[model samples]
Target: MTANVNIAIKHTSLLISGALLGLLHAGLANASGYPVTVQSCDRQVTFDHAPKAAVSNDVNLTEMMLALGLQDHMAGFTGVSGWKTLDPTLRNGIGELKELSPKYPSKEVLLGADADFYFAGWNYGMRVGGGVTPDTLAPLGIKVYELTESCIHIMDKPKVSMDDLYIDLLNLGRIFDKEEQAQSLVKGYQEDLTNFQANLTPLKTIPKVFVYDSGEEQPFTSGRYGMPTALIEAAGGKNIVDDVQKSWTQIGWEAVIDRAPEFIIIVNYGDVTAEQKINFLRSNPAFKNIPAVKNNHFVILEYIEATPGPRNINAIKRLAEAFRTAL
Candidate 1:
């Protein structure tokens, strides 16, 4: 057999031995109320115990792991270059960990790392037909946990909410045996959100906000189902494309011009900088009449902040401050 096969076989053998020991110490497992199972994207995954060697994929998932201070549990990570944009505190935590790859690693690469758990979500770490799909990794004794926000696109979820972030943190806490830490984190975010909402009571005018993800031909924007909608609503503003229904979508510039947004929210990610988007809006003659472009009323939010995670509360606070000042 080849070296990879040999490694897989050896890992499989070790897993069997560990599982048998776990069964023998059933009381110990029960002591923590594990073999806890969580449902993700219409599938169920059970965790017998905290993962000893975990691999975090994507910026949101990586931040979640780091926020919970689970770097010791993580073997490595991949996907996204948010470290350059992350806050210094969080960036320091990530700086200490090994980056398995700059992008999503293939099945063989993942297997080679000997990861017992994968902190990932649909279309984030494992794509629909990607070789390292959760289903494929299950037989190899790896558990995959999907981030709750990504579930809106992958599953038949009703809509996106701030609760998604809570549940994700709570679930991660459970997996890592850090339920108390999770609760504390969720409580803190909830408190911050409550404060933000309370501060909005004095504001009478809610700006018509346009979220700019990217695209010169047609702007990619967040719809009612994305986290941005919640952020906008929480920040005392309205999303012009709130009727789109999908998480992120492409809408024609004419549609945007018709709506005539007063505030523009730029999503900072990919190759496109927030300045580039702002410049595009300023330079285009078609956007000359638009209130947001005319007044240069643009709020630049980091891509990580726009997504569902620890940074969401920060996004809300920043947007709230901006709206109050702009309006």
Candidate 2:
């Protein structure tokens, strides 16, 4: 009976030891700061820690990181086309970085760089191109963050708003443990927006505005949901293309003439210059007769500032101020 009692106590102790081990593992897993899984657009991404060595595939992501004061963490960058109107400092900094391939880096290159995490404006850079799928990177202990705005199918036609831009800044702040800096920047932006709106002369009427992005084959126009609409509303004008539901849409020149916008914003992308756009419009038989062209009310905005990101608010303010002066 004494021997049986000893065995029983030993078994009990063994069970307790196993339980303790399990609990210890759970604690460690919880303490490791494993990223909270969130569904973005079409996929699930796990951001394990504050990204130390980062790469930005989109111009807006780079702008957001710069705004958050996390520029030092950038490893390499792509998407330089958006910086046309940016401050010289930013444009020069990007010019100095190695041109990142449109696709993800190779496994050998990725491993050599030893990047802690990757941030991209869109997921296509990760999933389709190169062998940099999430599974491949995960085994090497790399994390990726895709911008919420880029996650289109997940949300019901996400409308790009200044509020979304501010939230993105806050999210980056939380990820990088720079909450205070992010808050300060966001607060300042809010103040700027509020002041701009309040001091503005009440518009007796909002002007009809047309935003033209890239187009030779198909003209890209902003729809009700994205940076274009936000820009139009913020600029104290109406987006003639607001009825279109997509972020970008293609329409006939007849439609533009039918609406007869009072002001036109021409967006220049990559090597394209504003002068080229003006020339194109002037030379084109269809666009030359528009009231905006006749009145010389066309303004040039770089493609970067026209996208959804931190710089968007500034773009809106500048455009609004310009329109106020023009009126």
Candidate 3:
């Protein structure tokens, strides 16, 4: 097997083990209570009781909540990324909530909503400039749970894996007292993953792939670790810049030419069309001669799906299909 496939197999195995361990621990935890304190994102948040009203600051949290069938408990949402495509019912609900603005309702609005709990996908939304701090919300009897994968600077280090997605689902299930529903959802995801894996053919070779995301002045590319690496492997391609440790890194034009990737996935963000992306690459003197450009083997995916979350599975499938067709 190629190195990328080996890496993917090893990574998937480790994630499975870690997920099993996590599920075991979660199973043993005391479940009988009005509320529980779960440590996430380097913070200990005690949910004194099952929250009746809640607000989400990130789309992942919203997705998780809706998946857990806890939408009825959601009071509002703020700072959601515009890239995500939500379920029709959830989108309509958000529209109604926006019209209401029932309480604290700004990108900076975190208080005055009188929500019993606050769940954020990224802690950056609650940091200094984020309009609401945990301390400020705590005084009003509101608690916050920040998604562990998005936590950047934590000493103890939360383990992140593809399984963390399922763990997040289960955790939300616990919070909403929908354990059965959560299990069912996790099972469905596992089945989806299994089906995808079964469809995988033993790779004869790992195709070279380049991930071009937003960056007009300086291009952003996936590094060795994190979501992009996972996505690349899943798509049956190898990231040209996989030696770097960071999730993403800036690389010069010369390095990209040297790699000479066979396929390029241009991550579409904010008002950028696929044709515009192709034009941008063709206009770049440095990239004009690359095989990807010459062969027109470029694909565009939404920025939100490219990030880590439930949408990542969709991104992987789309990417795999795109590469398969191009190859």
| Candidate number achieving the greatest lDDT relative to the actual structure | 1
Q: List candidate 1 stretches off by more than 4 Å.
A: 1-31, 82-87
All models: lDDT? 0.76, 0.64, 0.65
The alpha-carbon deviation from the true structure for residue 252 of candidate 2, after best TM-score superposition, in angstroms, is 2.5
TM-score of each: 0.85, 0.77, 0.81
Supply the global lDDT for candidate 1: 0.76
Residue-level lDDT tens digits of model 3 in 231-270? 7776677888877655556777677788899888887655
* TM-score (C-alpha) between model 3 and the true structure: 0.81
- Backbone clash numbers for all candidates listed: 0, 0, 0
- Give the better candidate number (2 or 3) by lDDT: 3
Decide which is better by lDDT, 1 or 2. Answer: 1
Rank the models by lDDT, top first: 1, 3, 2
Candidate 1 lDDT over 1-327, as tens digits, reads 233333432332222233223322432344466777665667777787899989988777789888898988988888865333445666687876777877887777677889999878766777777688778998998888887767766666755667667777777777777776876787777776775555353455557899998999988899878889878776767789988877877889999999999999998877778899899999999999999999989999987789877899889889878877877
C-alpha RMSD (angstroms) for model 1? 13.0
For 194-309, candidate 2 gives per-residue lDDT tens digits of 66665565555677888887676566787776676777776667789888876666877778888988788988665667787777777788776787887788877776677766
